[model samples]
Target: MELSNLTGFLVHRTDVKMTNFFTKILKQYEVTPEQWGILLVLDTERATSQKELAEAIDRDQTTVVRMIYSLEKKEIVRRIQNEADKRSHNLFLSDKGMSLKTKLMPIVKAAHDHVTKYLSDDEIQQLHEILSKLYATVKDE
Candidate 1:
């Protein structure tokens, strides 16, 4: 088989293309893809701890801390002392972050829709399920 026809290579190419597309879009907001992932998780799960955010986003603790610091500096997120654990801090979206989410949600949804436009509803569901299973298997390994 030709190297160019390998499924893994093709998938990686597609991944890079998609990443570039999203990165371009996110650049307008001055955020990176990883930061966007963190914001998305935080939006969905409010008042999450740094450790929890790291796990939720499948990122290392140090990386999450750095992103959190950047977001804090931007005034988009705040780190409040965790009452239950004085050593830990809970993450919260600042008013600025909430406003950014509100402004960017439609753009995010549009990008999602555009990417999945070729798939039927059933196909989309199946794709999500299959990807979820694949993730679970890899995570368990």
Candidate 2:
């Protein structure tokens, strides 16, 4: 068992590489891959509470709060008080965020395509299925 052949090592290495690539592509927008993930989720789930956002993004609440604050400061996200919960806020993408998302969507797609350029569609699908299974197996452990 070489370190290079370890499942965790390989998956982590791939994640780091992909994160770096996404960070480079998003540098001009002043957005990190983590922030991009938040924005991506918000694009589909509007007025999501911070808790919901954290769950959706698979991040801890504290980290998600910090990311939300950064995005809010950039005018990319807006947090409105939750009517049902005084201590919680629902997050939404600002108009600027929506515009940014529109621009980023294609670029992100291109990035994905670039990364998987060598893989056939079936291979990509299989890869996703395998990854999802791995994720599920480790999620609670």
Strongest candidate by TM-score: 2
lDDT of 1: 0.86
TM-score of model 1 (CA atoms): 0.88
- Total backbone collisions for each predicted model: 0, 0
Which candidate gets the maximum lDDT versus the true structure? 2
Q: Summarize candidate 2's per-residue lDDT along 1-141 as a digit string, tens digits.
A: 799989999999999999999999999999999998988888535688888889988999999999999999999998989889899998889989999999999999999999999999999999999999999999999
Off by over 4 Å in 1: 1-7, 43-45
State the lDDT of candidate 1 residue by residue for 9-114, as single tens digits: 8757978989998898889898888888877877534689999999988988998999999999999888999999999999988888888888888998899899
Q: What C-alpha root-mean-square deviation, in Å, does candidate 1 show against the real structure?
A: 2.0
TM-score of each: 0.88, 0.95
Worst 10 residues of 1 by lDDT: 37-46
Kindly report which residue pairs in candidate 2 clash with one another: none
Q: Candidate 2, which segments miss by more than 4 Å at Cα? A: none
